[model samples]
Target: MLHADLDSFYASVEQRDNPRLLGRPVLVGGGVVLAASYEAKASGVRTPMNVQQALRLCPHAVVVPPRMHAYSAASKAVFEIFRDTTPEVEGISIDEAFLDVGGLWRIAGSPVEIAQRLRARVRAEVGLPISVGIARTKFLAKVASAVSKPDGLLEVPPEGELQFLHPLPVERLWGVGAVTARALHERGIRRIGELAELGEGPLAAAVGPAAGRHLYALSRAQDPRRVDTGRRRRSIGAQRALGRRVRADDEIEAYAHGLADRLGRRLRAARRVCRTVVLRMRFDDFTRATRSHTLPEPTDRDAVLLHAVRTLLTAALPLIHERGLTLIGLSLTNLDDADSMQLTLPLEARADSTLDSTLDALRDRFGSDAVTRAALLHRGTGLTVPMLPD
Candidate 1:
């Protein structure tokens, strides 16, 4: 098993595209810090922190707005490279994946050689730094990647897994968070080797029973999970945060339409159709409400999904007016393969379908902004941050 993770994905992309930002402290995002370059990190800047605080930490950092489209394109290209390296690839996020290369030893050389080649390929082709960890188990592999970061590689041989793992801090074990670390510290158990000396009963008393047993087993290097690539997503969705800004009904509707358009395209691209359309809303006060409608038939057509979302949005207008919406999102659920779609449709429906296909092709060739709905002409879709992969 090999775990591959891109180092500071969003910030690295910004630096990679602009030579001026290279080797400089870079921060990405506006209201909050989504990613910070290693230079910025060295100055105490961290992701998901307040933008103002990040700047205060690294006053000289170059902050850049996120480009969702570019990130999406890069993620697709990276995943393609991963799949090419090994068929059994499990994508954990936009910039991380797990590749099982155990079966390719004879054909691809040893695991260490494969990992080196994979890292070299990513840097040469994608122009990004990636850290890879190789181990007999997935959990250990993931931990190894973190231990050797920022364009580094490390492998834990089966014969010496314990020797490599014992001296590490207890926090390296799965499920050991700040609270757990503090609890362990109080008990004078700061290392994995020390924790391994405790019995399950003592470990459970320190933490909860389940977490204690889990940690006890993991401290012994007993993770049994595998890299799975056949998992299917339960839903597809997109959302935009509205901060403290109060939005008008028309503006909110336009954003909703935009989310629908993006989600619809994703559904079509995945060759899936959904039966349920759900509308999620958040008010300025931070309270949220959800409304959903299930279609009689699954459909990936943009008009159908957008219309359903609009109906739900219309029904929630009263709440929006009372609470003042600050966020809007759309989700499609209960999906099925597009091949299951009916072979026949009414003449008008078929005509609309043809138009949808044509629009999709044009957008694919020219770009998402090549064509836009009349409603979005005045109020743009707003900034969309690229989300982690499913």
Candidate 2:
């Protein structure tokens, strides 16, 4: 198993395209820090941090707005290389993927050799630094890649997996977040070796049963999952982060409508229909909430989706008013191919279908801005972030 991950993907792309940003601290996005170069990270700048706070941490950092199209193109090019390397590539995100090269020992020399070649290819062809980790299990491979970051490579052989893993911190184990780390710290279990010696029963007592089993297994380097490429995305979604501000109900509703509109178009473009519409919100206090409504029938129509979105948003308005929202997100879930949808006879429904098809056609031929909703005319459409295929 090999896990290959691009280092500082967005920031790397920016630095690669512009020579001036090569060795400088580059921060992507305006309101929030989306990606930060290693130079910026050295100054304590982090992703999702407020840009102002990041600037305060790294005063000389160069802030750049996110270029989603460029990032998408880079992702496509890199994935092409991954597929060319191995047919068994499981993409974890736009910047990382797990590959199984077990069967290529005779043809490709060894796993370490394959990883070295993969990293070299990415740097030479894509002009970006990538880290590659080789191990017998997927979990160890992922952990190895994370440990050897920013253009580095490491291999954990089966004979020495424990020697490599046991000395690491307990936080290195998956699912050991800040809360879990504090709980384990209180128990005097700070290392993976310590946690493994604590026994599964005691670990379960410390954390919940399921998480305990998960962390305990990872502590022993016992992941058995393979790199699977057959899986498809369960949901398609989009969200916009609104800076700290008091937005009126109408403005919020407009944002919801805009999200629904974009998602509906995406669903149709992907030839998928969704059975559920979910509204996700983040309040100013950093708390998150979600409300979902499953429709009687799957749909890709903008009107149907917008209506469901508005209904969910309206129901959550009282809570939003009380908490003050900082973000709005919409997701269409329970997706199935559009060809599976049954045809209906209502004339109004047929008219709506025609309108949807016409608008999609216009947008595909000309541009997304070819048609617009009256409500969204003056209110600018929020940024369209790049996403993996649905």
Candidate 3:
């Protein structure tokens, strides 16, 4: 069984502590709607919506900057409670996780009893409400959690999975986005139960074999996936929206180099190196394209990755001009664990990798802006990307 959510997560935390903000429409960011209270969501304010637009929808909404530190602290507290209750626990995200209580089924009386205790502890100790869903599979557990929101708990026994899942909207299936849902709807399959009636061949004809078959399997609640121990991130990449204007290739390459440098630092910190570097370019018109090339060897060298990215940018210059490039991104994939210690290699081996790590250490101890590539020094923007602690 996995309890897979934080009920109103960020919004609920703010409302819980700040009694003044209770019951009023609230949003959690100044620039964009990072989160919105359910009341604010009713008025069309939603996550990722522009703050200005959210304000237009709910004029009285209290918008606050994100308090990530507070959220992280709260997550730790909740996970502690979860660990206390169950031995086999897997965290999927900061606010959502899985608790495998198979061992405690007898000790805690039953899964239901354990869930009740876990929910009570969260509401009492963490001071935030959450939703819990119990099932034999991770997929059904997630579905159950979504169905039972706002401090609710739902349990779906193994034999009752299809009965509980099939009648749901097509959107309930994992990876079914709005576009996929619309495609399914066009085939007159709005409900998962309806999809069950469309045999494999006809379903494949409608949405392509891979997607249709997957959806059909999920519709039947026939998932065999287990709660994995979790896999290390194969790559780290970041991109910034360049507003709605065309930028020259040299200017964009400079920014791309900065992004690669940051990614390289993260890779080194994670002790991971990549053999493939991917470049993503997005145009002002919203069309995007990506290209990837394998390096000579797996390396976390910034110069190697940036040189590849520059070559890609040079080749992509024509398309950038044609589509009006508005965004550029860099990613390192095909990873292997890197060594913290260095050794002499072929002439093409990293010359700056060691130097980069040293500088990264300085920047970490001091501040990032304290060190900069001499070329980027002229521009003075140190580095920009969302970084999660490795």
Candidate 4:
């Protein structure tokens, strides 16, 4: 079964520990509302809101900075409980995870019972509240968790997956985002229940051929997505908001190449070779789009990923060519867990591994973006990476 998530995690922790902060509006992160307590939410403070604006919404709200180490320590304790319950655990993110315990019903008890114990353990040990959603499929379980948020547990029986899923809004599906929803809405398809009426052909035409069929299948709760254990992510990548909109293609290419290089470097450091490149772009309006391509061969090299990223830039560059842009991210996928680099290829990309190693050393010594290529010379500290201030 799958578990959903925690509601207002950071703020919940802060409120649980401090008696005075309990029942009062609380906002984490003085710079931005990283997490806002339910009280703060009721008062109009929201996550990602600027502190000043949030303060205006709730003058009496308690504002605090994020304590990553404290949260990390708490998360570790929570994961320990998860491990104790099941062996197959998949970390969805820092805040949530999934556990596959298909046959543990006898020892671990029923899904509902296990969820109750797990939630209780998390609250008792880590002092943070969590909501659990149990279901036959990972997707449904995640949906269930959203339904039973704020220290609650919800279970969708095997036969009820479709009943629970189909009536909800289309935005609940994994890949359905704002743009896709808008496209569906344009066709008078608003609810997941209504999607069944379109039939697959009409639905496909509405939201692109690729996404429409998949979404139609999902509307009927027909997901075959496995809880993959070998999902040893090939790369760890991050994107920074440029703060201001950027429209030029050259600037976007240079920025994307830098990010690709960073992802490739991280993949190499972990001794993993990725055969596919995934590029994720978040437009100014908070909507995200992704494109990916499989390389001819596996590589942990910077230039290979950069070439694909640049190619993707040519495709998506047109959209942002005249418009404002906000965030861009790149990641490498199809990872070969073992670095089985066969040096037998007749045509090889330039062996710039040495140069990458040198640049990485420099960046480690000084800071990231410290040793950039000539192409990146004018991209002066574009979007900043978060750093500990002196």
Candidate 5:
């Protein structure tokens, strides 16, 4: 197994396109640090951080807006390389993927040679740096690639797996988040080797049973997970962060309508239909609530999905008022490919479906702004944050 991940994906793209930005601290996205160059990171600037704080850390960092389309194109190009390298490819995110080369020794040489060639090809063809990790399992390969960053390559042979992993900090283990790391610290378990020595009982008492067992196995490099290429996304959804300001009912409803329309378009584009509509909300207090309604029949139609989402939102209105809503999200789940579904639509339902298809066609040809629901005609269409494919 091999894991291939781009080095500072967004920032690297910015540098690749402009000669002046090379070897400088470049920060992408002012509102949030979407990606920071290695130069910026050395000054303690990190991604998903506030731009103000990042500027304070790296005073001379150059900030740029995010280019989602460019990133999407780069991702497609990288995945094409991945597919060319191996038939079994598992995409982890936009900039990272796992390639299983278990049976390619005869044709592609050893895993190490394969990884070196893959890195060279990406740097040459894409004009971007990629780091790769070769290992016996997917989990270890991912960890290895993360450790070997910014145009580096590393491999862990089967015999040296524990030697490579046990010396690392406990935080490097898969499930050790901040809270878990703090707990491990309190127990004087700073390294993976130390955690492994404590046995499962003590680990379970420290964290819950399931998490402890999981951490214990990973600490000893006992991950049994394979490179899965058939993993399908269980849900498709979109969300908007509304911040702390209070919003009127009409405004919130408009956001809901826009999200439903966007989700409907995505569903149709993927040629899939969903039976369950879920409304996810986050309050000002940072608490979250979810409400779901399963439709009688699956649909990718805008009217059906919008109605179900509106119903869920209406049912949750009292809680939203009490908690002071800050974020609204909608997910369509219980998915089935459109080809597999046979819907019996009534005359009125068929008319609505026809209108939906027509509007989708117009948007695809002209642009997303070509058509808008009457409710969102005046207010600008709510922002649709492009999500990395699952």
Candidate 6:
């Protein structure tokens, strides 16, 4: 398995298209740091950081607005090169994918050679630099790719997987986020080998059963998943990062409604319906809370989704008021194909579906901005980042 990822994707695209941005710090997005060039990153700028703070970190950084269409085009071109290299491709996101070149040893040559050719093709054809990592398992391949970043290629052979993995930091494990890292750190288990020596029972006692089992298996390089091209997204969602400024109740509601509108359109566009509406909130202190409500029936209608979203938001309002909300997001999960939906008895519900399809058609023919909800007429709709098809 080979994991190929573009380096600083959005920022790289900006630098690629313009000569002035090359070899200089580039920051994409105006309000938040969506992507930062290696130079800006070296100056301590990170994604989702406030633009003002990013400037304070890198005073001479070039700030540019996001060009979604251009980025989408570049991603498509790179994926084309990936498919040309191998048919066994599993795209994780717009800028990264896993390609299984194990079968092509007889025809295409070694994995490293194939990865070198893949990188060369992307740079020559799409004008972008990509890093590729080869390993026996997906988890290790992804980790290797992250380690060999900014136009690099590294491979972990089956015989050396353990030798290469165990010495790394425990934070390098797939599920070890900030909280998990802190837990492991406080326990004096900072390395993968240290965590592995703690035994599964003690690890489970430390981080709960599921996560413990997960980390234990990964600490031993035991990932069994394969690269699957037919896999569909289990959930579709969007979020907006609101700066530190406090917002009114109506303002927050407006953002939630806008997110619902975008997500509903995406669900219907993909011919899928969701049974669960999840509300994700981030407080000013950077802590997060999630609330989910499962619908009695699956739906692809905007009105139905908006109602569920508003209900979840209302339930989280007290927490938001107490903690100070900084970000709000909505995710539609428990998904199924649209053909599986049962017929509704209510005439009003059927009419709502009709209106949703009509609006989707209009937006598809014209543009996403062509049709707008009355509530979001004057308010700014949150930024819509590009992603793999739902």
TM-scores for all predictions: 0.84, 0.94, 0.84, 0.69, 0.92, 0.89
Point out where model 1 deviates above 4 Å: 162-219, 287-289, 341-353, 384-390
lDDT of each: 0.88, 0.90, 0.80, 0.76, 0.88, 0.92
Write down the TM-score for model 1. Answer: 0.84
Runs with alpha carbons beyond 4 Å of true place in candidate 2: 342-353, 365-367
Single out the weakest 10-residue window by summed lDDT for candidate 5: 343-352
For every model shown, the clashing-pair count is: 0, 0, 0, 0, 0, 0
Query: Per-residue lDDT for 1-390 in model 4, tens only?
Result: 868476787888788768799889999885568899988899877768989999998999998777665666666777888888887887776678888878788888888888888888888888888989898888888889998877789999988877888788988988988998898888888888899778889888787788878888878777787666545554566575565655567777777877777776676567678877877877777677888889998877677778888788788876665445777877777777543665555756446458767777788688666787677897653433222110
Error of 2 at 231 (Å): 1.2
Error of 6 at 327 (Å): 2.7
The worst-scoring run of ten residues by lDDT in candidate 6 lies at: 344-353
Candidate ordering by lDDT (highest first): 6, 2, 1, 5, 3, 4
Query: Candidate 4 — which residues are off by over 4 angstroms?
Result: 241-269, 273-339, 343-390
In candidate 2, what are the lDDT values of residues 43-145, reduced to their tens digit? Answer: 9998889999999999999999999889999999999999998999999899999999999988888998888888888889989999999999999999999
Best by TM-score: 2
Model 4: lDDT of residue 168: 89
TM-score: model 2 vs. ground truth: 0.94
Candidate 5 or 3, higher TM-score: 5
Better of 3 and 4 by lDDT: 3
Write one digit per residue (lDDT tens) for candidate 6, span 169-240: 998998899999999999999999999999899999999999999999999999999999899998888998
Q: TM-score for model 3?
A: 0.84
**Model 5 residue 253 CA deviation in Å:** 1.3
lDDT of 1 by residue, 242-301 (tens): 777777788788889889988888888788889999999888788889999999888988
Worst 10 residues of 1 by lDDT: 344-353
What RMSD does model 3 have? 3.7
Better model by TM-score: candidate 1 vs candidate 4: 1
